[model samples]
Target: MRVTTQNGRVLLQNDVVNAAPVISTSELRGLGMESVAYIRAVEVEGEAGFAIHAADGTPMAVTEDRETAINAILQHEMMPVPLH
Candidate 1:
């Protein structure tokens, strides 16, 4: 798995292709995932938004509301840290 950031958004790249994929950012957090995830406030398409990313810089999700974004991470039982 490869994780990187582009245009202030996190991007995750996986090499393996399978029909039944189980491992995911939400899954990782749901199982008390030990990986570090980051929540960053960003502007995409000229609009304000928030993005969730893994410790290695993999993009998880993005939302327009900060609270919604943070809450989503919390709901998954993961910590959401602000970027910068």
Candidate 2:
């Protein structure tokens, strides 16, 4: 198991190919689900849109609509989490 931190969050990287590794909640704020992402509503240049970001808060992409943003995240094998 490899552990790294980015943006003050702990990230556990799985090194084993086919072995199932158990992780703790304190280990990852978001789990080992590789492509976890979240969507947020934003106004860019006076245009309403949705913005997709990685678990570490890195900007991924922006879409004009909510459905399209969700689809784009899913297409990339990323889980879209709701932000409050």
- Give Cα distance to truth, residue 28, candidate 2, Å: 3.8
lDDT by residue for model 2 over 1-84, one digit each (tens)? 678886665667786777555454445566644578899999999999999987767788989999999999999988898887
Tell me the TM-score of each prediction against the true structure. 0.53, 0.62
Most accurate candidate by TM-score: 2
Quote the RMSD, in angstroms, for model 1: 11.1
lDDT score for residue 34 of model 1: 56
> Compared to the true structure, candidate 1 yields what TM-score?
0.53
Give the whole-model CA lDDT for all candidates, comma-separated: 0.74, 0.81
Q: How accurate is candidate 2 locally (lDDT)?
A: 0.81
Which segments of candidate 1 are over 4 A away from where they belong? Answer: 1-35
Over 1-84, each residue of candidate 1 has an lDDT whose tens digit, in order, gives 777876565667787675344365555666654545688888999999988887557789999987888788878877766567
In the order shown, the candidates' Cα RMSDs to the true structure are: 11.1, 10.0
Candidate 1 residue-pair clash tally: 0
Give one clash count per candidate, in the order shown. 0, 0
